[model samples]
Target: MIVPTRSSFSALSCLMGRLFSVYAGYEQQDAHEFLLNFMDKLHEDLNRAPHRKGPPVPLPALVDEAASLNVRINHFWCQHVDRHLSVISDLFEGLLVSSLTCLVCRKSSSSFEVFSCLSLPIPANKGSVCYLQDCLKLFLETESMSGEAAWHCPSCRQKRKAEKRMIIARLPKILVIQFNRFRCETAWQSKKLQTYVQFPISGFDINCFVDREQVETQPRPAYRLYAFLNHYGTLATGHYIAYCRAGHGGQWYMYDDASVTEVTLSESDKRNAYILFYTSVDMRHQFSSHP
Candidate 1:
């Protein structure tokens, strides 16, 4: 009664095949041909039988909605100084005033400024993929992609849970990460944050999210009172790596726990730099008594 066809048979692979085909033919401009190809893809998707028990990720949307912001810069530190002359301070002012002085370090000696100007042997050309990669890495660190563990606020202090809300104070190259640690505000009540926190700069929670379900309900007795970083989809901009070498040349990320390496910045450290934030997601302050 019915005709068996390839589109109906092995539908998923066929759908995948259409995707590949579309990708390959994307640059080809033929309205009639494109319409036919598009129709084929639509048919494949509609007919593709999916088993929900399989992997969690839905098939890739395959549609390019917008461009990604995975951008970076070579000798970014040098560039940072160039951009934030104020952060570089006297040297930047000197460079602006005196043509001979180095703009970055404000050194009078020709050798120091001259040597400093040479960034990365051959500085990678601007707007290269390397820069984009750096941007992506920074985004990952700051947003939901950040993998650092959580710390708990005092009121809902669990084993290692922190509040969802975050506020920061930034000055030049100095940054204070303010986390809401749970401690007693007064004798009677447990408060969110009485003191402004100055957590060390460290790797961020990439997957920031607020548990809509949990926020409304009581956190599970076992795992109560916690906030999410970012999860799944979140809005973000700019990026950077905030880490230092712990041992060897191997760098380490800063975290709520013992991972962060505390360093006091000096005028020298501030030589050629400005603040760079990797990502900032709209965080959840509080929901309700429940999860």
Candidate 2:
């Protein structure tokens, strides 16, 4: 869901109400049912008169609504409200296997973590980072943890320097990539990285980001861009907009506040992209076939 900066509660309510209206037409039973329940509660709450006029709802609060809805859906499903309501977890959840290697003994340890999004840091260079692959490569690159923060190796039984890296143990149907652009070194000062990152509209293969052993055995998943959230301006104050395609290989449109207009593939569209949304091509085909 997209809303303008400094938007009123009424504006947010209207946006969500319209979204639910569109979801009402979807044929997916599990998703439709879950959204219907959420929409009903939301409508009831929004319809109630406020005691007094207060500050406008922040963007982060609206973002948290998704998390709130997910929790509610999980509770309802686990309570046997629906046996087939695993769509949210199935589409967004994925596992990451993080490995740390001791530089001295070469002893390695690994752990699994669950994530719904992948946050990547833009590479620092004298020149601009030109491609999304460069950022992805930097994310998978090994870094040494030494000095005061050295890793304590159990095998070596001492504080030793270690190399750490993370690999995708499992891939999700919907992959959300967040660009780490905001940096805060001190309590008072914060900065936004304006590095231009080039990303592909389609055929983005993330096989290199996966564990080498897994990549050797399994087929690499091909992803196609579906939507992206962009932030314009600075870290302290910025406007959020989104560009999304209607269907697989469909035309793209820019969503700014309540206004939406068709946009062509161009460099201008990539300028402020903060979060990229990609879907597995295989999964898209499966969904289209089933639908």
RMSD of each: 28.4, 13.2
What C-alpha lDDT, on a 0 to 100 scale, does residue 50 get in candidate 2?
A: 34
> What C-alpha lDDT do the candidate models reach, one value each?
0.26, 0.67
Per-residue error (Å), model 2, residue 15 = 12
Please, what is the TM-score per model? 0.14, 0.68
Give the clash count for model 2. 0
| Model 1 segments more than 4 A misplaced | 1-129, 132-140, 143-148, 160-291
Q: Per-residue lDDT tens digits of candidate 2, residues 107-197?
A: 7766556666778888778256558898878888888889987889989999999988877756777787888888896999888888889
Candidate 1: worst-modelled 10 consecutive residues by lDDT: 114-123
The per-residue C-alpha lDDT of model 2 at residue 34 equals: 35
